[model samples]
Target: MSQSPIVLTGDRPTGPLHLGHYVGSLRQRVTLQEQYRQFVMIADAQALTDNMGDLSKVRRNVIEVALDYLAVGLDPAKSTLFIQSQLTELAELSFYLLNLVTVARLERNPTVKEEIRLRGMERDIPAGFLTYPVSQTADITAFKAALVPVGADQAPMIEQCNELVRRFNNCVGKEILVEAQALIPDHGRLVGADGGAKMSKSLGNALALSADSAAIAAFVRSMYTDPNHLRVSDPGQVEGNVVFTYLDVFDPDKAAVEELKDHYRRGGLGDTVLKRRLTEHLEALITPIRERRAQFAQDPAEVMNILRQGTERAREAAAATMSEVKAALGLSYWN
Candidate 1:
């Protein structure tokens, strides 16, 4: 029988994943695991490109992200859940791949450019930060993953990875590396509670998957609706309304949600009433995930063991690929 196609995806271990993650990638991961040979990486090394000063935070969130993964139904039995920094081969591969790329090319990557601008590092971008696309190239090619699920903003990174793939294959006179394609989520991006263009943990505008009932309620109450919606009898705009945006994704009762939107637009439904319904739906959705996360958090050792085993499996695959990569570049000397 033919083997399943490999799918590589991951999260940076800087913070607990939020609803943005769920809507953008997490939900897709749960389904993809059943159909693909999936590898879910906890990207600690990449997280440290900017967070080098906060090593503890990065280390701590590795387990936190793993917990989130488990809570959301990413079965280790189906998906290889590994820590990125544990695989030394990936770093070695990245070094060789870096020679194939240039500073000008890295700067032109839209995802990298936006990240640098967001961190206010335009004047002082870290070397690692600037060249991370190469490292990402190493991560994807190491696993020979054909499918990489990512946000729309990350399309440039995948393009850069494929460029290196084609360049390295041409230099070697053969296709030594496999190119990857990005799988963007259909829901697009989930807006932040404050109505930002995106929901981000660092921005403090996200609702985490592990949030409690009180936190969920508070977040919903603070959600950005029509600013002109000052009273219960005013016609409200729903286009950019964060509450309806979330309801459209989370609330299963589509007909009810549409009716609520109609009532909201016609000038009788209060923001408080709408927010209360949203809070209830969000609470119902999150409570089970939070409980599962708590169960896993109670057994940190088992979680670490799972990561160790996954890393070992990942190391084997990476080591095999590195050997081929070395042979292609004529670096395998002691054979």
Candidate 2:
């Protein structure tokens, strides 16, 4: 109940949000809205770092992502929801923060490196793509946000941000900026339907939250379970089972899920039956969200207005911080 902390968290406006997003941060954002000063960003600029080829995709999805935020119960009155590119101060701050970090340090970032390796952009990495850590630092520090909710993989990026915070403050001989720490949730990473290490839109391995019943059925059918459990009577492994993994996060009745797990391990439950349960649970859960999204989709203008209002408020905060940053460096111009 203590709104003592300022929290910053967001998603890239590249595609419709998926279950990985909900489990990773969206659900948490809904709760944090009541207890923290939260700012949820539609990271369009960051999305563009990789999607520069089709700028239209990034622009179009900004509203889609915003709709997802609202449908997931993010109260705009309690949380500022803004588009990342609309804040000019963040761009300016990123440029200044870039001076403090080294290229080698960025290259060593496990998150960014893994992304580059995954996208096979190693041979043709854009300068913007490589410098995103600095940009993230700007995002965190601009609002003086002290807490950032992220997945386990993104915690190191927070460390990178704090390092820059200390380096800049020390250089300027003042603590004008705040250091941030990651608030990683218990259910961290949700792997893909292919049993891949992570779920992502680019990899085409995610079940989007807004997926219709047919799409949901397809994803559940495609989900990778234990490969060896070919027969209904075969004892199955649960540790790496993707269907069970989704159930663990989605199913409301833990006792039932555990009992089903026992049944699968004891060699009677079939993948079809297990997948049917998942499909049923997912449909029940997603129907209302999909309905709400449909309503919002009817009035995209309303969504844009909400974003513009939040962006104006966010911009004011960023401008205040930029003034302090400039003053710290003795760079504040006249007046």
Best by TM-score: 1
Best model number under lDDT? 1
Worst 10 residues of 2 by lDDT: 1-10
Worst ten in a row by lDDT for model 1: 1-10
Candidate 2 lDDT for residue 242: 92
* Local distance difference test values of all predictions, in order: 0.92, 0.91
Residue-level lDDT of model 1, residues 1-335, one tens digit each, is 22889999999999899988988888899999999989999999999998888999999999999999999989999889999999999999999999998899899999989988888989599899899999999999999999999888789999999999999999988888899999988888888999998799778899999999999988998898999988889999988999999889988999999999999899989988888888988888889889999999999999999999999988888899999999999998999
RMSD of each: 1.6, 2.1
State the lDDT of candidate 2 residue by residue for 96-129, as single tens digits: 9999999999999999899899888884889998
- Cα distance off (Å), candidate 2, residue 55: 1.0
Clashing pairs in 2: none
Q: How many angstroms is residue 22 displaced in model 2 relative to the true structure, after the best TM-score fit?
A: 1.0
User: TM per model?
Assistant: 0.95, 0.93
